[model samples]
Target chain A: MTPARRRTRSSAALRVLFAFAALIALTSVTAVVTHVVNTSAGLIAIRGGTESAATGDAAQVLASWTLLESMVYRSVIERDAVERFPDGTRIEFRSWLNPAFITGGYSADPTRTGVRGALIGSLWLIVIATIAAVPAGVGAAIYLQEFSAPHRLHRAMRESVHLLAGVPSVVFGLIGLVIFARLLGPLTSGAIFGVRATRVPTGRTIVSAGLTVALMTLPRIVIAAEQAIGAVAPRLRLAAFSVGATRWQVVRDHVLPQAGPEICAGAIFALTRAVGDAAAVIIVGASTVVLTDPSTPFAAFTALPVIAYQWAMRPDPSYRGLASAALLVLLLVVVVLNVAAGVVRLRARRTR
Target chain B: MTQDVGVANERVDTLSTEELTVTYDDIPVVSDVTVGFARGEVTALIGPAGSGKTSVLRALNRLHDLTPIARVHGSVRLHGKDIYDADVDAFEIRRRVGMVFETPTPFPMSIYDNVAWGARMHGRPSELDAVVEHGLRRAGLWDEVKDKLRQSALRLSAGQQQRLCIARTIAIDPDVILMDEVTAPLDPISTGKVEDLILTLRPDYAIVLATHNVQQAGRLSDRVAFFLVDESRAGRLVEWADTDSVFFAPRDARTEAYISGRAGSDMSARGRTG
Candidate 1:
């Protein structure tokens, strides 16, 4: 074949192949969307316990009720219950703050009050875990990356840390249950802190749960921190050392600041993961619900996912709505975290 | 800024090696080579690939210590003082003799920071801004990069980056400057600019450049060293002479074949006698 004609034929064939590939990609996207829609419809039907489409007024009322529920009905219902739900109902409502153990009021009623208790519990766990984990994890990573060299023991330790990161959350829960709840929790509660601490009778309290979740997430944060620290160009370190900066000075002034955003980003992601982790909390026995907030660190607590699970599994059909609402709240929190991360990334880029 | 040619006439020899041999990973590289570099003059080291031009250049500033496995035998004297003497601190040695490497490995930093790094490393001139500006001016980059001092060194074109590397090295005000294929990566015009920088800087510093470009060596160097690979594949200094004499009347057949593009033409000849 003439070189020119051969090139033309090949180019034409390539164009056809690219078109075919484009068609496949479009069809695949359509198929995925269709599958998702169908699955969601099926899930909605299962949740609703109805195959037939709702009749005219029923469909309209349900749709409008959803809107009202979001915008106004929830507030009105909450106000009415506060005014007239009875002292016993109020006390049960307050037990959510205590967890079922030392319950003052909050209960698993799937009410707005109960869901609020769950939200507070989850947020407390996430925030507390983040506070405890960030320093510990990032400190360990800094020590490993900047202070230590590759020795057999250190390498083994680093590998073990990575291994810890891969352990199942449920397994961490079990460990937390055995160690913190069964051992340290009781010791700390009975001897030192006092009656308030002992309110977590089995030692499986908010503090224990938070600590457990921190342990479960610690390895992930450390590993990511290590990676971020390691990602700093060696030239920077060399430059610092050549300028007579002390080793610690290099880390404190240059390395850590440069690694701050990445480490914090990883820690935030880990904390978000900790927020949604129900399995570990479940193992740590986070079932108690007190309507009042924990006055102390050792206080028992329940998390949103556990509460959502309890409400969602209930035989009552109305409780399903509460589960959906809780799910929506969780999604919102995750979205907020992702958006904050995006903003931070943009700022970092602009600074560089 | 041409040096007083009388500088060469005054000292005759500013730096010299006695029976220098080097090895890496137990493999012999350069062996039994004796040469001298003249004062305030450009001395070019040219040789075939793996003829140990770089290893020899690195030894001059004791930079070979940076490589854990590199071994050296022989005494290299600067102003009659053996540079490798135990009392000589490597940092002090490096401060006195600076190097610019191939590929323009500028610090991942602002252009101003890159220029000031060496000075900072050597604990010189507390006024960093002034030092940076002075270094850039000397490098002939200040006019183009004056407005972009805060910009990343990497933002500059390759030629500018190479000059930035030179500025960084000279910022510390070293007595000797080593250029290892500094212009090999530049276009002819950029190469000429660098060659001009070399010429202008000669009055203030002694230069030892290792280049594969024979014509470049002829054009810029006052003295030339020709290295030859012997049967043992170890580099040997065959001849070191005045630049014109070396290029026009090279004493060694290997040097003649090399300059004429005949000896080991397919392989990179890296040795230049300095």
Candidate 2:
């Protein structure tokens, strides 16, 4: 080879070598940073918060502590309280007098203040938002991608959907507050069950928050669903139609199955956004004193973010520390959910 | 078979076309072209790209309805019945006049599903599994894929995929098979296999094929329809005659030049076979 050609080949090889080195460096840095962050956040210490040095149920052993303690806080302390078995080994105990056991206390029941309530509540919001947004958004996307002919009018509508995605979550909250919380709340509440259907003046209830988040997340589902549907080869669609498949059957069989995983991933992302969002709920009017777990859509409740926000703003140092822990819990929940989505997407791609 | 051939040739002698024209958006692509496909015979359509060979085949099958912009100026009749009659359904036309594409366009499904798709779509009775198997056998793919009927059609080699497509078209038991360069995108071995299959299948179905390969036309078809092209002008049918005569004694000099390697031809010269 000529000198110039040899030099060109050498440079190409050098560029590849540099890329490999950069990748290795990045991986090492990421590993080290993750280790540092995990250790500094006191993951193990958070578990220690539930441990107690005192022995026995407060009502059975320390009647004094039980008598003076509020039902909510005392209930939690009693549940975690330790007792020596007859054989002399100590173990944690649960008590019947705990306010969480019978009536809602701090966060519905203080005795049950583990990740259970946060998990169940987060799942509630996520599932609700997914149910509301995924079908509506993905259906719209399929219609646009497969059925709608390209023209100025259709193009404008597509652009409008994209623009709606750019609108802020707070804006969606304002709209939801006006529409779902105020206008539709009483109507739906009265229709479902007979009561003086009440709507909170501040629109931060779970139902309002979920509807708001669904509106905010709808555009993402639509865009992603369109992309997934578009990824199916045009020839397949032609084949279906040529075989006398109705437009509906073509979308149902050839388009939707191909797009299903992507739509699911979009739903998962939207759900994560809804579960982790605090600002919209704050704007709408979330409650601080939720004495019971949310069993009804209209039930006033405290979600993880709202609770974390309240705790973080408090003047007490211990409460701030508690808020930091809650923040950690929230972060973990989002990461786990996103990772699950990633796994599903990867599996679908491999099969395709 | 000889009696059938005698009758088919008599029909060919009497068959005629009247003022057939195809236009897209008021622009005539093929105009005033009159042609007839001989029954129970292989008729090769040889042309350059954009010469409307495949378009004519599609019009024959009433497949032009798939393209919303395409419009035909005259009627296409099969056995003296107008293909575009008001009562005629495109689906019925497709059932009678099947087609295979230039490229192997198998569905992203199992091999059996690929062949069974047409039969199922046409509402064939149950026992389509047997039809699928029989089609595969006819297309000479059954022995190789009998054990892997459930395997994705896309997983097959290029040759197998092409045969799978052929099997798919024939599963509906079409009276005519319109193939648009069905063997162009294949290896020499695979091309030879398909040529053999075509000759074998001619006894069962009338075959109309469009191909860029002059040698393939000479070797496989009975009658060849030559479509000629020139820039700034719509394509036209230059000649239609026996394949052997067309190859050896073409009426048009351009056709002669195309068949022999010595002269200019519209086809890609990268992979020529004498």
Task: DockQ each candidate and list the results.
Answer: 0.14, 0.25
Q: Each candidate's fnat, in order?
A: 0.02, 0.11
Question: Which ranges of candidate 2 are over 4 A from the true structure?
Answer: A1-118, A187-190, A193-205, A241-244, B1-34, B54-95, B233-236, B262-274
DockQ of 2: 0.25
lDDT of 1 by residue, A1-352 (tens): 8999999999999999999999999999998555433321111111111111232121111111232332334456445544653432312211111132222235432222345556667777877788888899999999888777556878987999999988989999999899878888665344355665535566777777888889988998999899889988765654444333456766875688778788878877877777888899999878745556765566667777886677678776545555554555665677688777667756876776
Writing each residue's lDDT as its tens digit, candidate 2 over A201-280 gives 33345676677777878888888888888888776765554444556766877778777887777767767876788777
How high is the CA lDDT of each candidate model?
A: 0.72, 0.69
Candidate 1 Cα deviation (angstroms), residue A108: 4.5
Report RMSD for candidate 1. Answer: 9.4
Runs in model 1 deviating more than 4 A are A1-108, A114-158, A174-198, A201-215, A221-275, A281-287, A294-299, A310-321, A342-352, B1-39, B48-97, B121-126, B225-245, B269-274
Q: Considering summed lDDT, which 10 consecutive residues are worst modelled in model 2 chain A?
A: A40-49
By TM-score, the best candidate is 2
Worst 10 residues of 1 chain B by lDDT: B265-274
